[model samples]
Target: MSGVTDLVDPPRTRRPAITSLEVLCGLLVLAMLFQGRLAALLDVPALRTGSTIFVAVCVQAMPFLVFGVLVSGLIAAFVPPAALRRALPGRPAAAVPVAGVAGLALPGCECASVPVARRLIQQGVLPAAAFTFLLAAPAVNPVVLVSTAVAFPAEPRMVLARFLASLLTACAMGWLWARLGRAEWLAERVLRRVECHASGGSRWAAFTESARHDLVEAGGFLVLGGLASAVFNVLVPAAWMESLGGQLLLGVLVMAVLAVVLALCSEADAFVVASMPGLPLTAKLVFLVVGPAVDIKLIALQSGAFGRRFAARFAPATFLVAVGSACAVGAALLGGA
Candidate 1:
């Protein structure tokens, strides 16, 4: 009976356990095997164009990313968590604007803001204030504003418009969060993750680990965003952009959406927007404001740092507020659209 049962069922086969390294190696081998075919496919004009854009965006954005991670690592390692708590105003309302203004001090890109924001929250700074800094730091920082100036050499008001719109968005979001956000919404685990890492080892070890971890995590999302932008640049019809040229409201809405999709770094988005000369300044202003505050890459980082619940609520609210802020501020500062 046993032999019959064994024969009928056959021996259960054990599958090989695959480590991540093994899986990665296997993928590399597969890629190598198809290298010739892949090269030929890539030679198609659209694909070639897309690849070029992808590489260009990645190259342009990577330095800022690296700089941001370095700053983030330094914050994690050397800056005592208590320093932030002591530095912030006791009142949440007052703290929010202060945090937003303080963002100007950090010239790093949005990639650098996530971990620093999380660190602030974990270290006893008000969540709302930390969030404001997160939004404002990338958008209003000198590096970004200067880049905007350089990109729109002819229209320098773009610099001021971007700064005001972004600062307004950050402060509004911060104040809103203070009023409505529930502490329970943010995942406790995410907050603790950074704290746990920082608690152990020497400052050097912490800095290196924080920097390395942040780079790996943020870099992947940045690359994904760059690839998406490249694909859109190549595949989205020029006619689509042209159609919205003179339609102020529609142009603003579409550019806001593009900002969310492109996820371009604050330091570099100005250049991309500059290239689209057909779009109204109001629309391009919205793009500049929205990209740094909320984008595919920023959302990913925010979700990782602040939980999906927080990110979902925060990102859309910030987007709507940003568009309104940009429109109102643009009309006033850059002349009526």
Candidate 2:
């Protein structure tokens, strides 16, 4: 047993570092070997279209991403966790709505909300309330609202429908989680990891570190999402989408699926949906509500911040609710057209 244990736990050694020269030489070798293949791959029409979309998404989302990081940093530095605990209403029922509406104050995209929500949950805020904020922040925020309004300039009611649907979807999910969610689903260790880093530094230091770490982590996932979306946008024929548009229920379903697949930024998704003139307003509304509340990129972020179990359960639930809420709100607001 002792020998087995010794063999299993061999001494660990530090990995040798690669110098800048070594990295450059390796890059040069790889480029030299792959130059012709790389050029050929770049020339493919589908690849070119995909690359263009990827660049456009990244360029469009960067400002909002930067702003979100700044806001997240500020929250970490100045907004004490204790303050949230005290400021929240005493009951979860009351707290959820308050938190949902509180999302209006933070105009960052969904990418920024994941880290902030994790931090809030770690700070003793009710998990339900924090989750509500997580869902609502990107969807109901002023920036997103303005974008929606701009996208549907002719139909001002679209703005109202989007806001109401998004808020309802978010609040509903919070209530559902409060009733059915188990503590075991959450990755509570994420909080501990955050706290460990936060404990060693001043608020300012903690703020910078948390902000930087979150930006890097979330940004990578964002790029991956963008790439996936770009590829789909280029490969999936527009006529296929147009064919799906005529049937109301089918359109809603397809748009909801596209929302998850595209994972467009909340600030810009309205425009993307609006670009498809073939889709009905109701279907577009579904796209707007679903994109912010639940998307592939958001699922990945949630899994990182919360847990895979949580995301697996929450994403589907949120998608269903978002679709229902959008349909109901669209019918009511858009007169069943």
Candidate 3:
């Protein structure tokens, strides 16, 4: 019996690792337990302001986010990869501009564009074209343009400058990526496809699953971004705008950075920038162009969807392209004011 016991191995038990869901649940429970304390802590004016900004950002973006995921799901379920491929130009280079133009039809904000772009790539749309659509959709869509026009009623040319700059930025980034992008830059998960079935019932299942998965994944990043944006908004003094007056180069750079930090919705950003005094049209154009193309919110979304490696490279490139495009177009249209 001793010899048999020595030869036999003992059964091993492994503990399950805690997942995000478990951590989230724990946080929720803690928050519930400390609700009064949390509310009391938010009584400070700055904290209250931050909370309001956070809530506003989330509320403003949620509808667009949901719309995007649904559209992504629809694409996954109904749009055949082959059909999409056939619809675009055979050559990726030629398809890029077409994709940028196609963006005009999608009236949703930047939050809405990210998932749709990812879905397009998953559905066999050329990466260059898909990327173009991603950048162009939020900036060039009619709703955004109309809002811009309304925001700057005195400067009708602002609308045209924004459209051209955004469109150019999108196409430029697409062309650049087509030339230099490596498949390894993207995470393995982004390229992997969720299997979709051909039958009607199966398609509906696929749509719901895809939408739910995307919403769950992207929603976390969106909340994180909103928190960051609120913090920055609270900490950054509005008085800085007065100091930047008469400083063209510095104003442009600062406004560009502010656009990234603020992460304002494209449809509403025009009004925000328009409200800021002491900024030239060129600086304002940079802010308008850069906000929709790349911001902290969009950065978080890109990092979540396409891994940090891709976002690290893509975000900076898009920023520079967007700024340059805005400057060039502003020069032509706004005459640098």
Q: Model 2: residues >4 Å from true position, as ranges? A: 1-14, 17-37, 191-201
lDDT of 3 at 53: 93
TM of each candidate vs. truth: 0.87, 0.87, 0.93
The window of 10 residues in a row where model 2 has the poorest summed lDDT is 191-200
Q: What is the Cα-based TM-score of model 1?
A: 0.87
lDDT of 1 at 278: 72
Return the lDDT, model 2, position 159.
93
Scored by CA lDDT, what does every candidate get?
A: 0.85, 0.84, 0.92
Task: State which candidate, 1 or 2, has the greater lDDT.
Answer: 1
Q: After superposition, how far is residue 318 of candidate 2 from its true place, in Å?
A: 0.5
Give the alpha carbon lDDT tens digit for every residue of 1-337 in model 1: 8878867966779999888669889999998999999898678889888888889867877787788778778777877766767898989999999999999999888877887787677667899999999999999999998889999999989999999999999999999999999988897865563443345568789889878987887777777777888888787887788787778889988999999977777888899899986788999999999998988878877777678898889999999999999999999998855
Backbone clash pairs in model 2 (N, Cα, C under 3 Å; residues 3+ apart or in different chains), count: 0
Model 3, stretches more than 4 Å misplaced?
A: 1-19, 193-195
Model 3: ten consecutive residues of lowest lDDT = 190-199
